[model samples]
Target chain A: GGIITQTPKFLIGQEGQKLTLKCQQNFNHDTMYWYRQDSGKGLRLIYYSITENDLQKGDLSEGYDASREKKSSFSLTVTSAQKNEMAVFLCASSIGLANSDYTFGSGTRLLVI
Target chain B: LAKTTQPPSMEAYEGQEVNVSCSHTNIATSEYIYWYRQVPHQGPQFIIQGYKDYVVNEVASLFISADRKLSTLSLPWVSLRDAAVYYCIVTDRTGGLSGKLTFGEGTQVTVIS
Candidate 1:
């Protein structure tokens, strides 16, 4: 079994600051996803990539940018941090787009002051 | 993507069985029901998925009726570690390369000692 690793378990940034979260997967999956989770809310998809160098936006992708640098790595950047924003960013990967299961990383908790 | 609804929260005692139900009245034929769990400060973890009938895995069991309007996730014996937010998502298998997953509010299950 392979694992998905996310760097920087916790992040504290100032308002309007830029922060980046990195994810690496060893499953060699073709699809990678980035999601944000707020307190008392479910995960919301921000961006996803079907293949390397491909990007697709989701409902809440306005403030985030994603990059699929390689088959094994996907990164998300918070364009500008908002004050009083606290959320957990999660990275997931799936083998294929059709009815396949996804494996998720532990997550990176971000607190914007 | 079909919209899903689930209970806001639930409480169960240890060693008891917990069943969380999700409703998707407008689910499409090409869509599938997926269940995931998220512990505090962690990313969501895939539990199970099914189109119809019953599907069971080592971690959880997903039961879908013939009508496919609803699905249930059954936890055999509840434990403290099982306390978390459970989300039900529906995704269209035929959707283009980026198969976006929509997450519902999710049901928070608290296991009492």
Candidate 2:
């Protein structure tokens, strides 16, 4: 009975502007992840954190940065928004590698105009 | 990271059993097969996972082959609300402590009434 909360479900940003997305999970899980999904596409890894203050780059790590400030919260920042870019950013968390049952947040829809 | 291959799309009718198959011929011994479903405008949701043999949960069932190269996810009963893109993935043991799951283009299941 835990919840992953993603702030600002819909985000609109101008080209070249920096945007930040936040994710908070009350599951007390040790690992957190960020993924990006385009329309009609599968999910792509962006960044992941194993524990607090740990950061690891994923396949789609370019142009984005992630932070695991605390065990309950992880945040993602877009270095520079791309014009006409639209995608959904998802956040997920799990206990550890041995147990891969992850809980994911609804997502933050990003639109760069 | 083990590569996975699954059908791009599938069709099923309401009240019918829907099974989606995935092949991971290069799966390692420690890797596990996982099934996830993504409804439109939502994050991917975990269905079931298994290492070898069969595993079932309240939502779905996962059957892995003895060779561990192929697996199938079965939805007991399909409905209009069950229509979504289903993803099959294998656990990534490349990064230490980073439990990354690579998602490929999943099977889009269209449910008919």
Candidate 3:
């Protein structure tokens, strides 16, 4: 019965600019994840955190940084925005380490001009 | 991580039954088949998950054969709102501690009037 909330539904940034997306979950899950989805493509993992102050990189984590400031919040930063880049960033959380079901946020649509 | 294959797209009429299949030939004993649905401009939502046999919830039913090489997500009485991209994911048991969930090019289900 908890919800995952992502701030700034839409973001428009210039090339080389830095942008940040934030996520909060009330489920008290131990695992939090960040994923990026491009047009006509499936999602790719960006970064994730298993606990507060813990970080883990994923396949597409080169251009991003993540922070788990607290148990209820996780944030992602686009180090440097690329021109013509447009994608949706999603945040999700799960309860345990094995066979956990994930709950996701609505997503933040980013458009880099 | 086990690789998964799913249909690119499917079309169904309202009130019809729709079945989307996913093939994971290398699925291991510890791996689980998970189904998620993503509406346009939103994050994916968990539909169902199963290791083998059949599992059903209020949203959808997951059917896994004895061999566990393939799984099917059945949506009964499809409605307009059911039009969305459905993703089948195989979780790596060892990677959950890092909060990673690999996603494939999900099957897009379009409900026609």
Candidate 3 chain B lDDT trough over 10 residues, lowest sum? B92-101
DockQ, cand. 2: 0.56
Per-candidate clash tally = 0, 0, 0
lDDT of each candidate versus the true structure:
0.88, 0.89, 0.89
B1-113 in candidate 2: lDDT tens per residue?
Answer: 43889989999989999999999999888787888888887788888888899999899989899999999999988999999999998885455633477778899999999
Evaluated with TM-score, which candidate comes out highest? 3
Instruction: Write model 1 residue lDDT over B1-113, tens digit each, in one string.
Output: 53888999999999999999999898888888889888886778888888899999998899997899989999989999999999998878775633567677799999999
> How far off is each candidate at the interface, as Cα RMSD in Å?
2.0, 2.6, 2.4
Docking class of 2: medium
Cα-lDDT of candidate 3: 0.89
DockQ of each: 0.63, 0.56, 0.63
Q: How accurate is candidate 2 locally (lDDT)?
A: 0.89
State candidate 1's TM-score.
Answer: 0.94
Inter-residue clash pairs, candidate 1: none
User: Interface Cα RMSD for candidate 1?
Assistant: 2.0
